[model samples]
Target: MPAALEESAKPVIIGRSSSHFTRVTRIFAAELHVDYSFRVVRDLMSSNPEDYGGNPALKIPSLQTPRGVWFGSLNVCRELWRRSSPRPRVVWPEDHDEPLLANAQELVLQAMSTEVSLIMGKLGGTGDSAHHTKMRQSLINMMAWLEDNATSVLAALPQPRDLSYLEVTLFCLVSHLEFRDVLPTAPYPELNKFCQQFAARASIGETTFGFDT
Candidate 1:
């Protein structure tokens, strides 16, 4: 390829706009100021890996780069940060040594995963199944815990940080619950307040959730 063509090339983010997991990476890309193209995964049910940017897990938000495809939201965000200049201060999961912060991160992710499972179950026509019922209860429990502790968990974080995975995931999870109509967020006042504050960022405005055709 010519130098111009090579310069024009950029990493591709494979995922849907409505997906919370994908939104997390998109927000990271925007905040990191890393330029990348968005490639929507049109069919979530597609068995072909190519539809998900060669992700064997058939998941979205994979990063397709010159080096290789990075799977999962965290991997893609790290890669995007690596490609950014004057990298911002990022707080990773390992930084949380205490149970409050650590467990908050755990439950945020667990709730997100549980939401995904519930959506997939609905699509799979496994409505009201035993596992699905249990997942719903688990999700509710996790959200309750998060709502009660969100303020303190956030307050306890180390100061002067550009971003943290926990915050991003929590924002996405809370916003997504409302977006997907999986649950009424009016009940989660603390989480809603956090979302309102987080939504003020430019990245959040740029990555509003919506289903893609």
Candidate 2:
């Protein structure tokens, strides 16, 4: 490819606009100031890896960089941070030594994955199956625990941090539940409050989720 073509490539983010996992990377991109092109994954049901930026997992939010393609949201975010100059202080999951913070990170990711499964099942016309019902119950249980523990978990996190993956993922997950009508967020006041505060960030504002047309 020509030099101009290569520079014009920037970094291509392959994912759907409405996807929470995708939004996480998009927000990270905005925060890190990494200019990139957005390539929407038109069909989530497609089995073709090409549709998902050559992700063998057929997942979205993959980042295509000159260095290589990143497979998932966290990998993409880490690469973005690596490329960032005067990098911000990012608190990774390993930084959370305490049980509260570590557990919070784990549950937030679990909730996001559960949400994905539930949404995919719905889209696949399997929403009414027994497994789907169990998944919904699991999600509800997780949310309840999160609502009770959110404050303590946040308090345990390190102070004076620029960003933490846990916070970003939690914000995306809670806001997404309401966005997709998977569940009403009103019941989880603590999570709602956190979402309201997190939503004020410029990065979060820029990456508001919306289904691809």
Candidate 3:
């Protein structure tokens, strides 16, 4: 059993610490100085849908806030932002007009993350060549684009924001790639450096990587 949430204040974050999505929520909670109870759901192989009623998708990191239950990692983070007094300002420029770039970045992050997950799953038990090939090509393309454009793209971002959802999600994806040895780090030096700096954050440190039991 996990520790109970405080009655006076604080929200309950129910999820395993090992999930990347859950870690993102934990990092956000840590940044906001929000106390949360982490309900560990070890090994998805043994976890049932009933164990995650708060998130119908059966995803980890479902948050039970004072206002209501929040599903999805980013959704939970948004709720955390809302709950915080003098809410932490947006970490990315809200007025940016680079919709194409932003969308591309998000798509790449999602693709890379999905690739990592699929590959890891394959290594753990199942194996599929077509899936591996598709993920490999998608990741390769994304890395090529980032290697050729990351500096300029990042330079155009609004300063003082520190980080964005794109940045953090990308960072998590890249870190997972390395942690699982899914790909060689040499292919993405710039991304490697960005993740290194991002990982140095106190919030990130609190949510360091570990395999789910």
Backbone clash pairs for candidate 2 read none
User: Alpha-carbon error at 133 in model 1, in Å?
Assistant: 0.6
- Say which prediction, candidate 2 or candidate 3, comes out ahead on lDDT: 2
TM-score of each: 0.95, 0.94, 0.81
Q: Positional deviation of 176 in candidate 1, in angstroms?
A: 0.5
Q: Compared with the true structure, what per-residue lDDT tens digits does model 3 show for residues 1-213? A: 233343335677777655667777787877777767777776555447657635667666687765568887778888777666666655642345687457546665566567646766685765567766677777777777776776676676666774466676667777766676666768788878887787788988888888656
List the candidate 1 regions with Cα displacement exceeding 4 Å: 1-8
Taken over the whole model, the C-alpha lDDT of each candidate is 0.91, 0.89, 0.68
Worst 10 residues of 3 by lDDT: 1-10
- The TM-score of candidate 2 is 0.94
Per residue, candidate 1 scores C-alpha lDDT tens digits across 20-109 of: 999999999999998999998888889999999899998887999877899999999999888888899988888999999999999988
Question: Per-residue lDDT for 116-136 in model 2, tens only?
Answer: 999889988999999999999
Candidate 2 lDDT at 131 equals 98
Q: Which parts of model 2 are misplaced by more than 4 Å? A: 1-9
| Clashes, model 3 | 0
